[model samples]
Each structure stands twice: as C-alpha cells, then as structure tokens.
Target: MAKFALLIGVSEYQPGLNALPGAVQDIKAMQRVLQHSEMGDFADADMTVLENPPRHVMERAIENLFSNRQKDDLVLFYFSGHGIKDDSGKLYLSTSETSKYQSGELIQTTATAASLIHGMMERSRSRRQVIILDCCFSGAFAEGMKAKDDNTVDIKNQLGGEGRAVLTSSTATQYSFEQEGEDLSVYTRYIVEGIEKGAADTDNDGMISVDELHEYARKKVQEAAPAMKPEIYAVREGFKIKIAKAPVGDPQLEYRKEVEQCVRNGKVSVIGRRILKRRQSELGLSVEVAAQIENEVLEPYRQYQANLREYEEALAEALQHEGTLSQHTREELKRFQQLLQLRDEDIDLIEVPVAIEKDTIKQSEFLYQKSTETLIYKLRHQLVDITSTEIELAEQKEYKDEGLFERFTERAIEAIRLAQEETLRFGHNFIGTEQILLGLIREETGVAAQVLQLKGIKLADTRIEVEKIIGLGSGFVPPELPFTPNAKRVIELSLEEAKTLKHNYVSTGDLLLGCIRLEEGVAVRVLENLGVNLQNLREQVVHTINLSKNKNIQSQ
Candidate 1:
C-alpha cells in the first residue's frame, strides 16, 4: 500500500482574524516527520504542503488529497489554522482570505467548510485515512456523529469510511492554544516531539499507531496546559493504523519515560529520584547517561518556571511605582513577555491578581489619608532640616574620582559578596532583591543586619520567606551571576542615600535605606511578611545613623 498526504497551514488572515505565525512552521515540522525514512517512510513526491492558501486553493487541495486513492492506500490530511463555527454550529477551517463582519459574524463563503471535507472523505476509495486538525473548535468537525463504545465520536459516521481516524487539538467547545516561545502549537509540538523521539510507541512494538500518537500527545498537551483536552475519534480497525516506526528496545526512551513520571511541578520528587536510581540500574545505563536524559526531559518544565519568575519580578517592580500601569510600563511589560517567550494567557494569570492586590491596597490607604496627612506633613518638615544639615556636611568633605566599587565601605562590599553566595545557594543565576536582603542579614556586623535583628526579622526566618517567594532556580548557576534590575536599583539608591547622609562611602545603613526605599521589591515583601513596620524601620535606621554621627563628632 502507498502513502499520500496533504498538509495545509494558514498563517496570514484578513483583518478580522489574528495572524498565526506558527501555523506555517507547524506544517514544516509535520512534513519533516512524515517524510522521515525510518519513521513515516512516505515518498517525497507523495506529500504536499500548502502555506497560507486562499479559499479556492485550499478547497481544491482538500479535494485532491482524498481523490484518486486506492482502497489499500494510506491517505492523511492535516490542517493548522483558525477554526470557526457559525451560529448553526457548522465548523469551517479558515484560510488566508477568511474574513468576518464587523458584527463578529463569520463569512462562510470565505472559508472551507468542514462539510466539504467530509463529502470528499466519503467519496475517497481509501479506507485507511487519517485527519489531524490543530486549530480552535477542531473537534466540532465530528458533529452529528455517533458515539463509539468508548464514548468517542465515530469518524466513520461523520466523515464516512469503514477505516478512519480523526485527532483534534481541543474538545468541541474549547480553543486550541499556541504555546509562547514554541515553533508549533501546543498540540502539534507534542505530536512532533512524540514522533521524533519515538515516545509514542508505548507498547514497544516498534510501531506508532494513530491512537497511540493521539494518546501520547494528549497527555503531554494536558501536562503543559491542563485546560486543553485533545480528542481522538476512530472506528473499526482505524485505531490500529500504524503511522510511524519507533526505535525498539531504546534504553534512552525507557529512561526518559521514567523521568517524565518522576517530574512534578518542574522538579523531580524525592521518591522519583529513588525510583530513577533503581530504574537506571535495571536499564544498565551509567549515572552520567541517565542524568543527561533526565535533564533533557526536565528542560521544558524548568524553562516555563523560569519565564514565570522573570515576568513576576518585572511586574512586581512596575506595580510598585503606580497603581495603574502607564503606557511606557505597559510597553515595557510587553517587551518582557516577548523576550521571556511567555503567552498572553500565562501572563494574565500572574498579572491580574497582583494588579487587584495593588488596587485593594490603594483603596485602603485612601481611607487613612485624611487622618495621616498632618503627621506626614510634620515628618516631611523634620526630614528637610536633617537633609539640609547632611548636605552641608557632605559638601565640606573632598570628593574623589572613583567608581561605585571604590565608594562602598568594607562592610557594604562584604554584603554584596554575600549576595552572590546567596544566589548560588538558591541555585539561581541572578542576584535579585531577596538575595540582597539575605546578604545584608548574613553580614552580621553591618548596620543593616543590626536594624533587621532589632525589628525581629531573623536571618533564618527571612531565608525561609525568600525561598517560599521565589523558590530554588533550575540548579545551573553560572560562574558569574548578574544582578537583577531591582537589585541594581537598590545599589544605586543606596549610593544616593549615602551621599544624602554625608557619608563619602556607601555603608550598610545606606543599603538598608535603599532596600526600604524600593517599596515593591522582593526584599520589601519579605520584610513585610516578617512583620517589620517599614516606615518605623526607616526612622530607626536614620535615628541610629544620627546617634553614631554625634558620637564620632564628640570623640573627634
């Protein structure tokens, strides 16, 4: 029996539809796997790919895919694009020319209807047919079909054939999602990964059946995005149709599956580690080999978590400056999302709640504004006088041309060194505000440590809170860790505080002031969680600085 396939990818759409840049890439990926000699074994001339085809071109292609095929021939049709359903619930696969009215009504004539594809499928002589759809509302193509014994739609009844299979990226009512930072849609990515890695050959029979491929892709898609539920439909012997060949008795594949089971929330569980150790011995693989495989398996999860943390930190810093995000901040955030390869949906999950929390705090503060205005006014006047005296003293001292490093006191420098150590301890590659706070507390002789201790924020408790907030990193710390933007801002603010306090060198007290000044940083969050009163803490640090200044003046 010969194999023939047609793949359609629609990326450019009319004004009414959003562009899907990944759709074309999806077609390329599928083509690669389907033409692999050891896998799909389909001849190059037997496979066809159409990218961003117009409605008529797409319709003709679909007709040709199922036309003139023998009963024993294997026919496959794949589409990745927008899937729209009309009010009557008929699904249409969109094309480059697909458009909708301003009222949000679909222009049916502008797209290829599923009914046409079904008609083509019914007229095909080939019994071995596979239809794979990676698009929104894709499952709706099986509408009006009978349910099989397994409760899945009967493709034979809908698309019409004794031996047929259909796989959709999402349920009838759900939308198929494109993963951010990925070259293919979430469903298609797993599908390609399964075929390329031979992980779909679950039974180790060296063959990847259509049903097995769908099952493997479904589990992986759900793991990455639980809201998505990929569906598969088959009838008669369709479920047993072998789509590709897998490497049998592959030790790496065996180990990879075990590692998948061990991974949870992006990290290997303690029990999972023990299980992996035992599996390694049984598989007769060396420790280094197993570790390499496990790392490969875990990389995706770790990358996702890292993206989330980076976005969260950037959002937190932005929220500190204003209750409502300015246009500039919004643009900055968008850049962050793109740079971090995060999806809009994923970012919404982190941003919405944080914004609501900030709004709630603003509302509560407004309620007390009237009562605190007079006290705030008095404090401001007092601070002005203190600032004037400090500035006069600061000017009296001779200035030196030196870098920021030369301006730091020995204790301040030690605290920074401790910050890098803390970063390594947390397995993180960057020093963030939380690490800086830990460093300050660890430098026991620094004034920042003294103030923190007096406020009941112990080093041990702070460490716990820091871990709870940011968690451990991916365990690949670089030789030289960089400082996060917030961390760098803290150092800049500390230098300003030192200059304002008439200290030629940046002291630990100045660093503490800088941390307090950064209202939105992880450091401030930890301090608040530890029950430290920030305003009072700031006043105490200033008061202590004044007392030290007076003692020095008297001794001189």
Candidate 2:
C-alpha cells in the first residue's frame, strides 16, 4: 500500500505573530521516525516537509498530499505552528505570510484554514487518513465533534467503522506549551520520545498503534506540562493503525527506561545510583566513569542551587509586596520560603561535616539538621574557628541532601501543612503526634486513609476520638507553633520508615507508621484503644503503597 506524510512547521512568522523556536525541531523529529526503516518506513520522496511555508504553499501541500490516494493507502498529515481563531470563530494555521498585528482583514487570506484541511482529509480517496496537529487550539482540526462523552471502547468502535482519526496537542481553548529549557514543544517532545524509545507500544507488541501513540504522548505531556491536554478524535475505528515499529535490543534505551520509571516513582536518589550502577556494570567505575557520573549529578546539583536562589528571590519579592498579594499567593510564597530554607540546610550539610555521637541513623540526623538550619549558607566550611572546622572535617565525611524537597512529593507537603492546621485546630501550642495522625486522616486521598478505610475507620470518627483523648486545650493558640519533641521524632522516624520500605517520598503511610513505631505517643494510644492490630495495619499500609505505585506505572 502506498503511504505518504506531509510535515509542516512554522518557526518564523510575520511581524504580527510570535515565532516558535521548537516548531522546526518538531518537524525534524517527526520526519526522522516517519522515514525510519523500522518505523513508518515511508521513503524520503514520499514524505513532504514544509518549513515556514506561506499560506498558499501550505494549502497546496495538504491538498496534493491527500489527492488521488487509493482506498487502502495511508495518508498522514502533521502540522506544528501557531493556530489562531478569528473573530468569526474560524481557526487558521498561521503561515510565514501571516501578520496578526498588521494583516488586519487579510488575516484569513494569509493563513490556511483548519476546515479546508479537514475537508480535504475527509474527501481523500484514501480510506485510512490521519491528521496530527501540534499548535495552539489544534483540537479545532476535528470538525463536527460531539460532546466528549465516549470512553476508549466507544472511541475505538467509532474509529473502527470510519478509518479516520485526528490527534491534537491540546484542547481548542488551551495553548500548547514548550518545555522550559528544551528545544521541542512539550507535546512534540513526548511524541518524538514515544516513537524513538518504543514506549508507545503499551502491550509490547512491537507495533505502535495510533491510539497507543496518542495515549503515551498524552500522559507524558500532561506530566511535563500539566496545563496542556492532548486529544484524540477518531472518525471511525483506525485506532489500531500502525504508526511505528518498536525498537529492540537497545540496552542503553532499556536502562534509560528504568531511569524514567524511577523518576515517575519519585525515586530521586535512585537516579544517581542507577547511573552509577549502570556505569559500573557496563564500564566499571573508572576515573572516566566516575567523572561522567559526577558531571551528570553536578548539573542537577547546580540547577538545584540556582532554583533555590530563584525561589528565595521570589519569596523576597512576595514579602515586599505582601499587601498586594492574594492569600493563596502569600501561602505559596511561605511554603516556597520554607522549601528554600530546607534546601539551604541541605547545601550546608554537603559543605560541612557534622559529628554524630551515638546515632546509628545518619539519615534521621540529616533531617534534624535540615529542620534546624544548623549552619548558615554563608558559613559553607567557613566557620570562625578554623581549628574546629579542621577537626570536624577530619572526624567525618561530607554529606549532601541532594535536592532537599525532591524526596517529598506534592501530597506529602500538603499532608505536613494539614498537620500544622490540625495543631492549630486543637488550640495546641506545639504539633504533637496526635496532630500528625489527624493530618494523615484529613489527607482524604492519601494511601494511609485508604488503608484505614479498609479497617472501617473514618476521619470524623478519628477526630472525635482524638479530641476525647487529648482533652481540650486552653483558648490561647500560638500563630507559630513548633512541633513538639514527640512530633519531631515522629517526622524523623517517618523518613526512616520511608527508607526502610524502599520508597522515596515520606508518604502519609510512613507518617502513620512512624507514629506507631514511636510507641510512646498519644497517637499510639488512640490506635490501640480503637483495637487496631499494629502489625497487620502496617503490612496493609505497605501493600497499599505498593499497589498505588504499581497503578501509577500502569497508568503511565
């Protein structure tokens, strides 16, 4: 069967339209896969590429690419550029000749219309037609779309009947995004990666179907750019249309897959070790290998330092303009400030060596140091007493926190903040273990809550039980209540629990387990009174954590 592809990209637009740097890159990436022998296998002559083409050129390319094709022939059309909707609600693909600021009434004339391409694809003799648009409001390419009420099965059934499909980078209203420091747009980056890395083949079938490609790219782009959502509209059941052939026997790519999985699971430390282990297993940890791994680690380390400073500066600005900031923005600034403070402590730990007396838990001590901000950032190995600094350095090896907040997932941070709110609600001067328990309960969607639900425990019942056990506190509540010693210990042990479970983040489950393991807090007493079998409950929590992790992997 004859196969063809028309790849269009516009990186340079007229004065009125903003230029996109990644448009050209997107075109080149797709061209590579479409022409790869193992993938699309389209001959170089069969693939047409238009870079910054004018309105007429783009229209002619689309029309000619789809014209006079056989019923079984596959025709694929992809566009990467700016898509703008006119006042009349007609979507136009901005061309090199299009100047939104100066064209005035000629805007429609200077750009290719989405409806024109849709009409051409619908009318094409080819039974299998695929349109992929990567631009702002690209979803507009799908004409006559009904209300989005169908599931994957329904979409598959419809596509199976029609053999026509349209994929867009984002919804008709949302803007497609580019990565912060990458050369490709967020949507296109994943699209290229999915094809290149064989990740789009969800079933290990060695074939990347249109549906699989869209699903893989959609999930990835959503992860990297949460604001943009990719869409798939199938006119009939071409869902199984083979887009690419998966690669095999590539060990480096396989290892990179592991690294990606670790990232999704929030296993930041595992990333460095994975790199180190891969190097050692493949090349032995020679000087060159160590240097390479160190360079890799150092890039992110330096980036973390830069990011920490940026967050600090933003916090400073927010503080200066505190009166004009919204409550939500102010709260964000506060949380960011705390994160920066935590990062500074991490850097200091790397710079200075601390003496640990009678502590087998080096990680726990690190957390304590981070909480207290033991050394000022400026005091990076520059203490007043050079002799003491020398002695301390001689006594112990250096340590680094390695992106202090990376270990904590977004949910974990929310749980901690909720715990503080619990402390305030109880009118307590300090956060206690009971407050931590309440915080976990209040994190309704947390794994801890899920496990507790299986045991017939509810947040409301737990809150009542907690109040009865703690009794009412005095009306006086401090605005800046610190964690009580027990609470601090619980937090430390929670980190240990996370490490022991081989999980990266200190999850709500870890917090609950930590409180129970402490064995001397009001939290423990409450759980005991409620007739909880601590051992079984802990096991259930671990199981739930694993199940959630697996679910995330499968979804991705």
Could you say which candidate leads in TM-score? Answer: 1
What value does the lDDT take at residue 224 in candidate 2? 39
- In candidate 2, how many clashes are counted? 8
Q: Which pairs clash in the backbone of model 1?
A: none
Lowest lDDT 10-mer window, candidate 2?
142-151
The candidate 1 region of ten consecutive residues with least summed lDDT is 142-151
Tens digits of per-residue lDDT for model 2 on 531-552?
A: 8888877766665556444433
Q: Which stretches of candidate 2 lie over 4 Å from their true place?
A: 101-106, 138-161, 179-181, 258-264, 268-313, 320-556
The CA-based lDDT of model 2 is what?
Answer: 0.63
Give lDDT tens digits, candidate 1, residues 172-233: 65547664456888788989888998988888899999999999898777655554678887
User: Model 1 misses residue 9 by how many Å?
Assistant: 1.1
Off by over 4 Å in 1: 138-162, 179-181, 278-289, 303-556
